[model samples]
Target: MRKILNTAHIYMIIGVVSGLYSRELTKAEDFTGDTQLDVVHTHVLALGMLFFLIVLVLEKQFTLTSSALFGWFFWIYNIGLAVTVGMMTLHGTLTVLGHSSGEAIAMVAGLGHILLTAGLILLFVTLGKRLQPAPAPGSDAAPDPDPAAPLPAPAP
Candidate 1:
């Protein structure tokens, strides 16, 4: 859980930095048309920062790390995101400098998207495996609370 929280925090910082980078880079280049950098900011914020925050909450509820596939999901998803973001930055920089990005960039970006897709598939598999029925009450397994249950009365 701590690790998940830490990952979320790191992504938030990276997302903010990416947004600032997009703004400053576009301003520096004076290129007003659509650029991949613009999308990079939102992608990092939504897919990296916000996604990890959701995962952190899921970790608290489901102990995601206990799943064998969780480690793979973590590493693969991060690598995919990094590759995608890096290529977007590169392609955008070239565009800002009035250079055309070639087929190679598109191919590599496609690979990054493929990895992201595979990672998401792995995450879903892990989550499915973790969705076992709750352990019986008082059997030493962690309690799975009913969200609709009434809150306990405060101690006197």
Candidate 2:
């Protein structure tokens, strides 16, 4: 899981950086006004995802609860990244296709991005709930007795 999350983090960072650089070039060439904003949004979303990855990696407690929470958060972050990229692609496609009928496609894509962001936030909260340390075995609050505890004396 750690390996998967780290790989995802690296890929997301690379994608964001590339997108931003491309946007800068496009702006220099006087590309559409919305392109720049889309690039910026992608970068911001990537940063948020990276933060969650960091938290997952650094967290000390590894258990079923933590695993489930991490899985949920990981899903959200990936989904958000997907939505962000999808929106940018949709915007570009609409521009290229020369569709000016309702702008509904762009609006729907934007809505998807918003939903993804909300999901990521919810995941963060759920992760908090799972961050607690597991209780020690044998007692909820007390440490287990040493296995080397002296055996009872034999009856006379």
Residue 115, candidate 2: Cα error in Å is 3.5
Query: What would you estimate as the lDDT of candidate 1?
Result: 0.87
* Off by more than 4 A, model 1: 133-156
Which residue pairs come into collision in candidate 2? none
Kindly list the per-residue Cα lDDT of model 2 for residues 8-126, writing each as its tens digit.
56766756775665566556666664543456445544555555465555553333234555566556656765666656655654443443425675576676677677766766676
lDDT of each: 0.87, 0.58
Counted clashes in each candidate structure: 0, 0
Q: Give candidate 2's total backbone clashes.
A: 0
Model 1 lDDT per residue over 97-155, tens place:
89999999988888899889988998999888888787887789986677669999999
Among the numbered candidates, top TM-score falls to 1
Supply candidate 2's per-residue lDDT for 137: 75
